[model samples]
Target chain A: MKPHTLSVLVENRPGVLSRVTGLFSRRGFNIESLAVGTCEEPGMSRITIVVIGDDAKVEQVMTQLHKLIDVIKVSDLSENERVERELALIKVNAEPGTSRAEILQIASIFRALIVDVGSKSVILEVTGDTEKIDALEKLLRQYGVKELVRTGKIGILRGSKSVPGSK
Target chain B: MKPGAKILVESLPREGTEIIFGYPGGVVLPIYDELYDSSLRHILVRHEQAAAHAADGYARASGRVGVCLATSGPGACNLVTGIATAYMDSAPIVAITGQVPTNLLGNDAFQESDITGITMPITKHNYLVKSAADISRVVQEAFYIAGTGRKGPVLIDIPKDVSTGLAEDTPLPEKVTLRGYNPTYKGHKRQIDKAVELIVHAERPLIYAGGGVIASNASAELVSLATLVGIPVTTTLMGIGCIPCDHPLNLGMLGMHGTEYANFAVMESDLLIAIGARFDDRVTGKIDTFAPHAKIVHIDIDPAEIGKNKRIDVPIVGDVKAVLQDMLSGLKKNNAYEPWLKKIKHWKQHHPLRVKDDGRLHPQYIVRALSELVKGEAVIVSEVGQNQMWTAQHFCFHHPRTWITSGGLGTMGYGFPAAMGAHFARPDVPVFDIAGDGSIQMNIQEMSTVAANKIPVKVAILNNMYLGMVRQWQELFFDRRYSFTELPPVDFVKIANAYGIDGMRVDSPDDVVPALKASLDCNGPVVMDFRIEREENVFPMVPAGAAINEMIGGHPRS
Candidate 1:
């Protein structure tokens, strides 16, 4: 199944997240990644979700999302020209000498920040599109990665277009 | 200024509610106290489940939003089945549940429950009121949401403290505006034109109407469209009364336990116009082969239901009445379907719905007798299973809203309380609850509520000493290993008398009509127990997952 990004705006209310996620689970729709936060408008939240399905299945997902009372708008951004990014923090083991130097150089090449430097490990904070983050993580795997955390993909329309219901 | 409880009590009348079916508990005392002085009449049901079913019954019968109330935790939980029943059937209802004090909400307070979370899946929408000030707006919104779009139950959970707290005495809002919930009322013009094009050229078009027709009050439009186009009509259980059973073009109920002729018509039709009915599994057995030769035109208010089960050639998403009216305006009178009509007539004449006569009482005879006695004008409600199928198959319904049953959820204990609710909605009309022995015992406690109110609801129990439907299935599919389908005999007449209501038992076939007449003539609630054939099976059955044309019995030629 291809991953399709959907940007949804909903009324900021208690249990709204559960309602959306609950619908996905019950309807057996697969969700690849999801991120939720307040949008530009007050009393509204934007949920960016990466869903895996074919065209017909994705159409059904959009239609079902529209049925939820709290959801304000749903737009599929996969086909539109958009700017997308995901942030990931990777903590890796760093030896004292040459290995430490190599890790620092790799971080610099990827433009990742050395957020925390400990005696045995360093936490590298990376922000980029999903593929870029994946590439950096792949190279750092040789350095003995300790841990990794990611904020799932978030997107916005490029140029003058803004997601509807967000003023 | 006004207390939340008073505002809540006052809001009902403002929303045009004259009565509510409810059971009170500790958490709801403040609201009940306010209700004591209010003009709204409250019927105290014996159980919370009965309260919800009765409210649902009221909504279906009157075409209004029925209301029910219960305490938190167990009380709210008990209303789950009834709420799901209404949800599945798309009946409009507002359930008011009392929650524990806001401070104790999540601490597992003695009677606290996360009711809003529990009902989120079944309800159209729900609210857990956090402030006393939100009560008025929540009530107004709940009613509006429940009664609009694809109507279903909406619940409001008010904490006990919120009920006692004071808020500004604002007047009720004149209009409700929900940004995410505007329903499409008019069908897309292009789609309507396409549907008309298909209807115009179709040689064998069949109209498959369902609950949406009754919900939208579109029976007249449906009849007019069918008559003008000269298309034969068949109905789902919920669509039984949309076209009079005796109408020249009516083909009776379709699906499992449906008529043989109706199934035959569906198999041969070239165009299937589905109005306001979802393609439920029971209605569309073996979906791949259902109406195999027909191009489907599905019209429904809920967009989610349009392509949910069956693919549609012309999808018209709008209110049924509005869409039918649009189609009616674009159509011309056509009587070119004489060949198709003749074929259907042959099927109807050859394979009529029939039951064996062993010189013993049959449930079908009792239902037919009741229909004749009432002259097809009674408000007939039914419990689920064999009794429900028998009533739907045999009884002649000439008008909408006259036949109410638990079609979607198939809750067994639905009818008795629902019949009481129907009685309250239209006291002038004769109301009957045709029930099975096993199903009637589920909510038989409601007898006290009916007897106390002196409602003249007539109950006909087709006692077979078994869960007849399950037994039939076991006999057909399980090699006759009855298991627990057999139920111990209970004297229902004695139980009715214990509750201080008139009771009678009829064992002879000749006494069916006279017994029904006596029940109808009674001034108060009466229960008539008919000892029917214990092994009687409902015929013209379509085995689950089989095509509609694959029948087990009731084929005259076979």
Candidate 2:
């Protein structure tokens, strides 16, 4: 399956996300990763979607997206030069005398920040691809990880032509 | 300035009306007089409650804001039920009320009431239009807001001053901008990837579609994906029309009233792809146990709905059509083996939906006959109770947007008025409301909405003399101690006649076709009260707080 990214511009409205997600859901599509944020314009948002399908299917979806009244533009940014980032925050137990220094060293290697330091626990914030976050989380679990929170991924296409279908 | 009794008039066409379903009384003569001369048709209802139901019907059916007009005091108060009904269903309808003159506003005035406050909780927004200039804009904004975003009803209370005051603003055409009201249409890419990876690896995939498909007009996209990936499809009751029932992959409706095969499929599936649907309790019998083995990929337009019901493995938030398109782009057609499909097909044939045979007239029989008679082509609206469940069970919906019902709110007295609204939305197709006696009585006054509007909506009332769903429960759990479930019935034929509507009460199976045809043939509204046995029950009910498959059959009670 070819990985495709679509940059969609849409009107910023209440329940808009629900409406969009509802569209995918009703059609039984599995959305791999999605992110939404305010665009350069006011009252508008850029939704970066990464999906896996053939070129023809992606183009078909783009056409339908173009038809939506609120949808300003939809472009498959997969070929576009783009930057992607994912953030994950994980907490791990640091026993009084056992490998606390080693944990901090591991965090340092990953450029992760130790955001919280309690006598029994240490919370680290990590930013990377999904695999990097998953590996770090898994490695930290050996020390009795207490809690974890990861924001759903977000993405942006490289350069500034704006998404093709975004209004 | 004319006398305080000036007969104010407002003419309108049927293109874009917000609200107009209510009864006008003594002091509302001026507004009613204006209505009489106007092309804007007015529905004079037996009760104000029916007016709101009619408006809600219109809103849900049309996807446009519905308009219902009523007069002051008791008339306005009666509209409260319909307003609340629309509010619960999140239907976009604007109710206009004719108030006593400005001078009589706060005098504890005869036939005067504070309708704005009464309808406040039941509306997304409400306005008391004071000046005539504000009338058109207010009406326009009410529609704009009501039809946009979440799609809910808004109320406008027009005082006599505004209705009669000679303000020269056109009755239509204006732009209203709201600062904090933008809805997002595009979905995020990263989330799409996470969802796709899960779907690719999933051995058992289930796609659950909700009413939002029809709302977004994403039925075609849904069908494409379902067919593309060979995913099995189950639907929330409101999600009925999203996919045609005849599709090979369809699992029928899912919920408390859903078919056994559908519930079983949902339970056994390995991956659940929930679209547009908010997993209501009725749909997910026991949330913890529902799709216990499946990884849920929840793609919804609403973010709040994601973690509210069932936890998700992949959450895709965007419009269903666009998201489906994106998801389809990611597909490699790995669904070669149809394990889930084969199993569900086996279940469908093995445990087909059946009615009890005791030489008694059953509501299921009526629904089945109706489904066959209509060829699953007509728009079907059902009131809540056994009738709603039976209709869901028996009706084979062939097209998307054809089956309209009050699913989320489960509002009774919803069928007839909604059928009227459906008829108005799809004028060429015939619309039918399969209602239970108790449910029908809740908004029976809409008989006038049908008669006055000359909408030929066929009404099939399953007159069982009891609230069927609740009674079935009583028999199942409470040992047949039927309490207030039994109702003193009214002669629907006489009631139909009083409202200038035609009706037939059928007790025998032979009369079913004739009654259905008669109702269909009548130019105006027609009611066929099927005097079905009072003890009939809708089967395959999920026991309270149990798993979906742990259903308690509707066994007869002594």
Candidate 3:
């Protein structure tokens, strides 16, 4: 089974999200990762959802999503020329003198920014592909990471031609 | 300038809403007051559940948006199952509910329930009208959404204050545009061509038609396409009357309770041209093995159903009638299926739908007798399960919208209320609810509505004294451990008499015909209770999860 990433355009209406998600649950579909944001089109939102299932089932989910009234359009953005980004924040248990310098040096090499400083911890913010962020978090874990957070995958279609909505 | 209540009341005739099935209570008192003065008709049902079913039945029978209303809390909650039933079956219905006053909302005031929240999963779309001025537009949109695109139920929740308020506009908008909701009415030309290419080449093509054929009024086109292509046609339960039962190519129902010949035809066919039918589990049985040899061409207005259950070789997503018309217009007339027809005829001759009629009284016999008396001109609604199966097998249905049943949801007690709905839609036609003892009792209170409204519907109860369908399953699969399937003996005729309707009990096979005749001869609603064989089971059943071809009980040819 391959994972299919669906880029869905929908009306920004109350309960539309619930309806879409509710449909998935009722139909016994699993959602791996999802991210939603206002798109280039006014009053419309773009939702990128990653679903892992057999080709037939994934296709069924896409077709069912199309039936929802608020859903404007749905496109599989997986193989399309598209850029995806995920943001991560990691707080490491680094003491001021003993490990702060080493942590800052390692973070800089990965182009991650040291967003916060404290006597007992260092907060590093990383914005990159999911794989890159995963690698940075793995390295940060060796120094006793306090906490880590990630905004799931958000992507857009490539080229100048827009994903049609109310532009 | 009218209050929102009056506007909502006035909106009925504007949309051609003739009658409403509803129950009144506190929050909707204003709306009820308005209804009292308006010329629009209302039939107060015993429960909100019946109201939704009646409305759904009305929609199915008349091809119009049926309307129903209820007050808040339990009233709206009762409509839940009915709405879900309609939703699953794609019945066009608009359900209105009165919410608590705007100021008291979320405070959990008396008789207040989050009805909009409760019905979100069931309705195609819903509205919570907080403003009085928005009443007209909301009504318009609700009707529009409910009656279009894979039509299903829609809900409108109006707070008491909105109905009572009196702020106004000059005129309701002539048009309302939903930027997101545009239904694809025309099939894609390329897809249609691909289907035609597949159809022209396949030797054993079968037309699998469903409720969508009736919903789209495409029986004419369906018949034309089947005849032109020289393919045999098999109908789903909801598609029974798409072609006359006696038609040469008609192969009865397909799936679990389907005819043996029909199931065999499906299994052996190389090409499956599915028109407006979803491949439900009942039809497919073991999904992996279902139509294993067939190349599928599915045409449905609902894009969701095109490849939802089974894989599709050619998917034309549009109205069934429109797409069928396109296919008919484009295809060259070719009768290339003589071999296929001969093979099917051989199977039909060998595995005809028959039962051991060692009849004291049999439900199938009664159904056949009733059909013969009516001559395929009556409207037949059935309660779900064995009775439904029997009617699907034996009833001589000849027209669209004549056979109505809750096929998708399989909701018991849907028959009588739905018959009431169908009666209202076609007052001149004879309506019969062929029900099982178990299913009829589910909403027998509707007898009150029937009697009061003087709806000339006949309730033919096959009194098996048990939940026969479930019992049959238990007997076959679970070693005869019948648990909770046996129903207590209740005299349905006496109950009907108590409801102020004439009724009779038929105990012998000889009485079945006379009982049916007497019931039909009555002026108003009549219940004919036939004490059918207690242990009889629906035959040609493909046991659950078994392949469609592996059905259990049709005798081989002599």
Error of 3 at B98 (Å): 2.1
Order of quality (TM-score): 1, 3, 2
- TM score of chain A per candidate: 0.95, 0.85, 0.92
Poorest stretch of ten by lDDT in candidate 1 chain B: B549-558
Q: Which docking band does candidate 2 fall into?
A: incorrect
lDDT of 2 by residue, A73-160 (tens): 7777667677767898888999778978879988998899999999988989999877889889888888888999886566666677
Which portions of model 1 show Cα errors greater than 4 Å?
B556-558
Cα lDDT tens digits, model 2, B1-558, are 321222223322323752366677765666676666566656666677777777777666667767777778888887887777776656778777778777787788888888876665566667766676666666667777677645677777777766667656454554566443445566789888888888777777888998777766788999888888888888888788778888988888887877788888888888898988887888888888999998888887655456666778888767878888898899877655477677778888777788666667787878888778778678888898888888888888988768777776678887887787777777888889999999888878778767877879888999988988889889988999998999887799999989898889899877877788777777778888899988877777888788888876732311
Give the 10-residue window scoring lowest on summed lDDT in candidate 2 chain B. B3-12
Q: Mark the regions of model 3 whose C-alpha exceeds 4 Å error after superposition.
A: A118-122, A142-144, B103-107, B170-176
lDDT of 2: 0.76
Which 10 consecutive residues of model 3 chain B have the lowest summed lDDT? B167-176
Decreasing lDDT order of the candidates: 1, 3, 2
Q: What is the Å distance of residue A24 in model 1 from its true position?
A: 0.8
Is candidate 1 or 2 superior in TM-score?
1
lDDT, candidate 1, B117-202, per-residue tens: 99999999999998889899999999999999999999999999999999997666578988888899999999999999999999
Q: Find the candidate with the highest lDDT and give its number.
A: 1
Give the clashing residue pairs of candidate 3, or none.
none
Clash totals for all models, in order?
0, 71, 0
Distance (Å) between predicted and true CA of B7, model 3? 2.3
The per-residue C-alpha lDDT of model 2 at residue B254 equals 82
